[model samples]
Target chain A: MSILAVGTVAFDSIETPFGTAPRVLGGSASYLTLAARYFCPDVRLVGVVGRDFPDDYVQRFRDSGIDLRGLETDESGDTFHWKGRYHYDLNERDTLDTQLNVLVDFEPTLPEDYRSSQIVCLGNLDPAVQRHVLDQVDDPEYVLCDTMNYWIEHTPDSLRETLQRVDCLVINDSEARELANEPNLVQAADIIRDMGPETLIIKKGEHGALLFNGDTVFSAPAYPLEAIEDPTGAGDTFAGGLAGHLAQVGRYGADDLRRGIIYGSAMASFVVERFGPERLYHLNRELIVERARAFRELAAIPKLAPLQAA
Target chain B: MSILAVGTVAFDSIETPFGTAPRVLGGSASYLTLAARYFCPDVRLVGVVGRDFPDDYVQRFRDSGIDLRGLETDESGDTFHWKGRYHYDLNERDTLDTQLNVLVDFEPTLPEDYRSSQIVCLGNLDPAVQRHVLDQVDDPEYVLCDTMNYWIEHTPDSLRETLQRVDCLVINDSEARELANEPNLVQAADIIRDMGPETLIIKKGEHGALLFNGDTVFSAPAYPLEAIEDPTGAGDTFAGGLAGHLAQVGRYGADDLRRGIIYGSAMASFVVERFGPERLYHLNRELIVERARAFRELAAIPKLAPLQAA
Candidate 1:
């Protein structure tokens, strides 16, 4: 099963309390595709980069087994560049600058082969573009879409149209609350589910994430780290891991979703341990398995005999 | 095995976004003892109340199977009274009033029978009082102490001394950070564990809790609720349920502690569903078991074979 990821492929300058990193390889598609490669070998990336994009970085993605058939190089413009600074608590950060150079007039045109991808991950991008990609895919088994407050508030009609087509929608807690206009997350999930997608994942940064599928709900815990070097692209990475696992398993059962969420959480955990995608560069199957096992242990509760009714 | 709880027995006036309750039956010991009774039948309550306290409320404790031999009535002053107002988000609250009436001259004197209790729960109170209860109890198998930020700031010496004697300590995340002077929770847990208790549970309000025992860490998710009526005494109730479950199980294994935390979380969840202790009044073993099972479902993850080393 192949997983298609469509989003930004750009450069990021990140500053955290611990340290700072100059123009590093970043972007939604970059993180998502790299994380997805851990679970499934067939990960196809679709995004645009400028001439400024390094050849070594491009080689890194190719080395990780990500298909770049749909990736475009716009020699006429600069790549998307974002500068961000994190506060004392890494949960919140401010975007210092966002130069949408190549992304300004971006249009995603799925490659002929990518039209039959088993799973499609639409990263945080213009909802119109997400819908365009959706139009191209040939009945994807799973369509997982990620968005932010920007589209939800400014272009809700376009976002809602995208939501109606996707199988799952992933967003942070605040964005979930805003999108549904409900403060309570459970109720927010209910409202959002009613809007379109049957599955909704409300990510709560350090708190973890909640997966809502109709009447069923699953709670996943964040990997507790002593220090979080950088939190950029964690959410996108989580979405990729989740969709990738589902693609590999080729099922949508409750058990498979639960395992997917655990794997996704583990991938995101590894991403935040270092600046940008450096940690993911060193991530291996053994470390991922170990972390997933830790998650199992962390949440494991012994079965207690059913209590007699009082 | 028996469990002993020592803390305030007073009245609370609470205002939330949903509703308001005036001078209801509220206190640390009241909630702790009530929640504990659900797990351990022999729950000993030690606290001081004023003559103004209602006999009906006192009878409620007696009817709930809480041994009140250590409770005192200070006719000279009024009962401890707390008035609080919760913000829209229910996570933060403002203390409008704190009339430490009977609590001002309070001193916990455990009864002869309670001295032999297998577990002791020292609720949020002066560290000196918690230390006094520990001094009186006969070498109990477990001593679980709960504290707040006020004591951490005003009486560091006393709090430290109390921490040195307890087997386990339960406090919220902020207090843990402040007490350890470490902003990071994992680091904070490490620093606090070195101070005394081998086991530490850092409660993160709605985000849930973290259980740290040596190198082992267990994360518990707070039951997600669409409506929260009142949050008073949630932490104390959690402590009571946790210690009480341990007492009933008569063991301190990792499995037992994990079950205890889940039960504690469930009890706290039920408490916030309604104002004061009204919800707990109707809480039965069936409901507790059902909620615990729900928690199991909410966090349940399938075990996957370890991935091959890359």
Candidate 2:
């Protein structure tokens, strides 16, 4: 099975209480490609970069089995660049700069060969762009979409329209609540599910993530860590691991969704452990499996005696 | 096994997005007694009340097999009363009124029978009063305590002094962070464990709860609910179920602690489903067991791969 992910592939500068890393090879695609490489080796990435983007970074993805036929490099402008710094909690951060260079005019065009990928991950991007990717995919079994509050607040109609076409919707807790106009998360998720999508995942940074489907809800807590070097691409890393692992399995049920959350959580733990995408870039299958087991044990406790009604 | 709980018995008026309830039975004792009834038929409660308190309300506890002999009534004054309103999310609330009648002069005195109980719960109260309860217990194997930022800020010395005597500490996430002066919760729990308690449960309200012991950490997310009528007494209910079940088992290992959290989470789910203690009042063994099973399902999800060291 092949996984196709389309999102920003650019540069980032990050600062944490530990220190600052200026101009790192970072972006949604970079982090996602690295994190997913351990689970699914063959990942096809589609996004736009610029002449300023290093060839070494592109080569790294190629080495990790990330197909870049759909990647566009424009010599006219720089790559999309983001600069952010972590707050004391590491969960909250301040964005110092955002330069939409090649991304300013990016209109993702999927390669002909990528049209048959089994899994599609539409990372945070314009709703129109998300729709365009979906249009190009032919009978993909799973389509997961990630969006921000900016789209919800600015282009709600287009966002809602795009939401109807996806199997899964990934969003932050606040964004979910804001979009639903309901403060209660459960109700907010219900609203999102009703709009479309069989599954909804509300990320809560260090607090954890919640999955909602129909009347069923599954929650996985974030692996508590002592220090977070950078949180720049943690969410994208989580999305990539989830989509990639699910593609590897080639099936997803209630149980599969649960397992995907654990894999995503374990992947996220490494993403925050270091600046940029360094830690995830070197993650091996053995390490992910080990962390997943710990998460299962941490999440699993025996049920003794009588249970509350089923 | 019998459970001994020391806390205030007060009335509360609550308003939520769901609706409003006027002057409902509330406070730590009210919720604790109802939840503990599931595990043990005979639990002793120590607190103060006043002339305004209804006889039927007091009788309710007595009928539930609670030993209310330690409840001292002051006919000249009124029962403790508080009024608050919850936001739509039920995460935040604004206190509208607080009339600490008999509670203002509360001095917990354990009944003769209560002194022999093996389980002790020290609910939110003055640091001095919490310490007094500890002094009264003969030899409690599992003594759990819950406190708030109010006491931590006002009586740092007394709070620190009381911390030395308990086996487990239950506190809100913010309170734990504030007490330890650590921005990260995992680190905060570590700092707290050194203060005395062998176990620490940091309550994150709707986000669920976390248990930390030196090198071990277990996290549980709350069961997402669409309708939350009232959140009053949810924490006390959680504590009651946890302590009651643990006392029944007569164990305090890591697994036992994890199970206790599940029990607590189940009880809390019920507490928020109705106004005040009405839902908990009529709960049966089967109903409790049913909810417990639901907690397991709500929290249970499969994770891909096994955990291995990096």
Candidate 3:
């Protein structure tokens, strides 16, 4: 099983309360494929970069053993660049600028080899592009898709159309509320599953993520981090790790999905420790497993005994 | 083991997005002892009420087998009255009015029999009053204390003094931050424990509670509810249920604390289902147990197997 991740591969200028990272290696597909490579080796990347794309970063992807057959070099312009600033609490961020340079005109055409991938990760992108990628794929066993508030507001119909094609949809709490137009999360989950996606993950950042699968809701514990330098691609990293884990295990059963969310949380926890994807690029299996164990411990309790009435 | 709970027994007028419950039975001790009585029969209440205090409410406590020997009828004025309104999300509330009435000058006096009670729950009150109650207790084994932003701001010195005597502290996330003067909750727990209680439970309302016991932190799951009429006595009810569970088990170990938090959460979830303490007053052992089980399932993941390094 392999993952086909399609999204932006671009540069980000991020500013948080801690400091700033100017022109750092970032983007949805960059973080997704990089984090996914740790769990699944056959992770394929389909994204458009530009002439200004760093060679060292490209070498970094190859070093991680990511198949970049569909990584297009749109020499017409520089890569998609995003600038954002995070508040003091790090729970909210304000996008300062977005220059969708090459991303604006580039049409995604998946390489022939990537079409047969078993797992497909539709990173945060235009819903139409997401549909286009899905159209090219043969028959994905599991399709994990993500969308942001941008597409949810601007292109509701296209987003709803894409939602119907995916097995799982990963989004944050606000996006879930906004898309469903429901204040209560449990009700929102119900309304969202009606639109499509048998599985929905509402990421709450520090509050952890909620996985609404079928009629069951699993509350994955958030790793308590003391310092978060930059939260540039934590959500995408979370999706990547989840998709990668499912790919490696070759199963997406109830318990398997739960474990995948934990792995995703573990990956997200690591990515936020430093700027860009520095921590993701350095993590080993030992560290990942350890962090996952810590997460399990965070929410563990002995099986409860029924209390007798007084 | 019996619980000696010291707090208010007053009237509450609540306004929510759903509807209004005007001047209903409320106060910390009313909610606490009502929830606690399900777990332990030997519960004592120590609060002052006035002439206008309803006889039906007094009868309600009597029917539940709560020892009211420590409950004083001051008769100087009416009971403390609080008027508040909840936001649409039911997360934050603004205090519309607070009429201390007889409660302004009332002094709590624990009965001789109550002084020997095994457990003590100091509900949200004046820090000095909390300390005064502590002084009357005869070497209680485990003391659980709750406070709010009002005391944390107005009586920091008194609150700090009271903190040193309690075995566990139960407060919400924001109060914990304000009390510790630290934004990060994990770090806040460390700082708070240094000030007093060895165990700290930080309630996040809809997001659930976090129990920091020694080195282990347990993340308790929130029960999702479609409707929340009022959230006035939720924190007090939580503390009561926890203390009552600890008393019933005759233990306050790590697992005990973990289970106590679950039971506390179950009680809290029920209280908010109706106006004021209406739901809390009507809950039985079976309903409490069922909700606790639901909470467990919310955060339950299969005990994970260590994954092999890829």
Candidate 4:
């Protein structure tokens, strides 16, 4: 099965309490493509970038079996750029700058070959653009969408409309509560489920992620890391791993979804270990699996006697 | 096997985003006794109260098989009282008032019969009180102590001295970081293990708890609840269940510690579902076992084929 990932493919400068790096090739598509390439070799990448973005970085995707036919080159403008710094508590960060060069006016167009992909990943983007990508897909099996607080605050109706077309929704804990207007996360998942998607995964960063499917719910903690070099692209990498693993399995069950989360978490662990996509870009299958095992072990509490009923 | 819980037995008025409860029976010892009473029938309570404290409230402990012989009544002063309000986020609260009546000159004296208890739970209290309680234990097999930032910030040396005497230390994530002076939690656990305790459990409130032993680390997420009436005694209840389970099994190993965390999480689940200790007071073994099962189920992620190691 093939996967289609649509989002920004640009540059980022990020700093944390640990350290800082400047002007790195980092964006949703860049991180997603590298992570998803580990599970599925044939991943279709669709995003606009400026001419100045390194050819070596673009060539790296091609080398990793990611089809770059949908990668648009805007010769007139520099690539989209973002700079941010994390606080002592890595869970939150402050955006230092944002330069939406080519990204300001670019319209996404899926290649004919990518139109038949089975799994679609709509990374954080305007609701209108996300819908347009879905409109081009010819009956994809699973369409997972990731959005931020920006879209939720500005385009509630457009976001809700896009939610109706996706099978999975990946959002952070606060955004979930804000979108559903419910303080309780469980209630928020319920409200979001009612709005559309059959599954909702609430990413709580360091706390981990929660999965909700009807009354059934599952939670897995993130593989706790010691030093978080950079947090940029972690979420998109997570979504990529989830979609990639599910596409490989062809069926998404409780167990499969749980494993998918582990995969997503493992991918994210590497994403934060280095600035931009440095660590994830060089991540091999062996390391990914090792991290996955570490997560399983870290969260592996021994089973005690079962609880008696109320 | 019996458990000894040493801490405060006071009153509190709590207000949350959901509702408010005025002048409820609360305190570390009160919550610990109720929580420990679930696993081991014998829980020796050692604390001080005042003349205004009612009889029925004390009777609740007597009915739960708690030895209240060490509970001193100060006729000259009023009971210690606290008032606090939680924001929409239950994890944080603003302190409204703190009236240390009997607690001002409080001196805990372990009953003659209490010194021989096999399990010791040193609930959050003044470092001096915690140290006094430690002196009373007669070669206890398991001594677990809980502390907050109050002591960590004020009496660093006394806290360190008390920490060295305990086998397991239970503290919040921030306190753990603060105590070790390490920014990274993983590294903080390492420094803490070097300080004294054989194992460390970092409580992250709703995020969950992390247990770090010599080379093994286990994590358990807080069971997702629909409503959190009051978080006043959740941590004490958690410690109670942990020490209580250890006393019941008469064993404390890496595996047992892992199971202990799960049991603790289960007991805490009951604490927040109602006001003060009302929910936990009526808890039975069957009910606890059911919640323990739910914790196991909630943490169950489908096992994946081991990732290929690099």
- Local distance difference test, each candidate: 0.88, 0.85, 0.89, 0.86
CA error at residue A140 for candidate 1, angstroms: 1.5
Chain A TM-score by candidate, in order: 0.97, 0.96, 0.98, 0.96
**What pairs collide in candidate 4?**
A307-B289, A307-B290, A308-B289, A308-B290
How big is the RMSD of model 3? 1.5
Fnat values, candidates in order: 0.61, 0.58, 0.59, 0.58
Q: Write the per-residue lDDT of candidate 4 for residues A57-170, one digit (tens) a residue.
A: 887888778889999999999999999988887778899999999998878877888779899999888889999998998989998998989999999999999999988999
Each prediction's TM-score versus the true structure? 0.96, 0.95, 0.97, 0.97
Please list the residue runs of candidate 4 whose C-alpha ends up more than 4 Å from where it truly belongs after superposition: A306-310, B306-310
Instruction: Compose the digit string of candidate 3's lDDT tens values, residues A209-296.
Output: 8989977899988887777788889999999889988988899988899999999999999999999999987889988989998988
Docking class of 2: medium
Tens digit of per-residue lDDT, candidate 3, span B243-270: 9899889998999999998898889888
Give the worst 10-residue stretch by lDDT in candidate 3 chain A: A300-309
User: What i-RMS does every model get?
Assistant: 2.5, 4.5, 1.4, 3.7
Model 2, A18-107: lDDT tens per residue? Answer: 899988988777777777767776788889999898878888888777888988998899999988888877767888999999898888
lDDT of 1 at B243: 83
Which model, 1 or 3, shows the larger TM-score? 3
Worst 10 residues of 1 chain B by lDDT: B301-310
Tell me the docking grade of candidate 4. medium
Question: Residue-pair clashes per candidate, as listed?
Answer: 0, 16, 0, 4
Q: Residue by residue across B42-91, what tens digits does model 1's lDDT show? A: 88889999989999999888888889999999999999999999997787
Measured on C-alpha atoms, candidate 3 has an lDDT of: 0.89
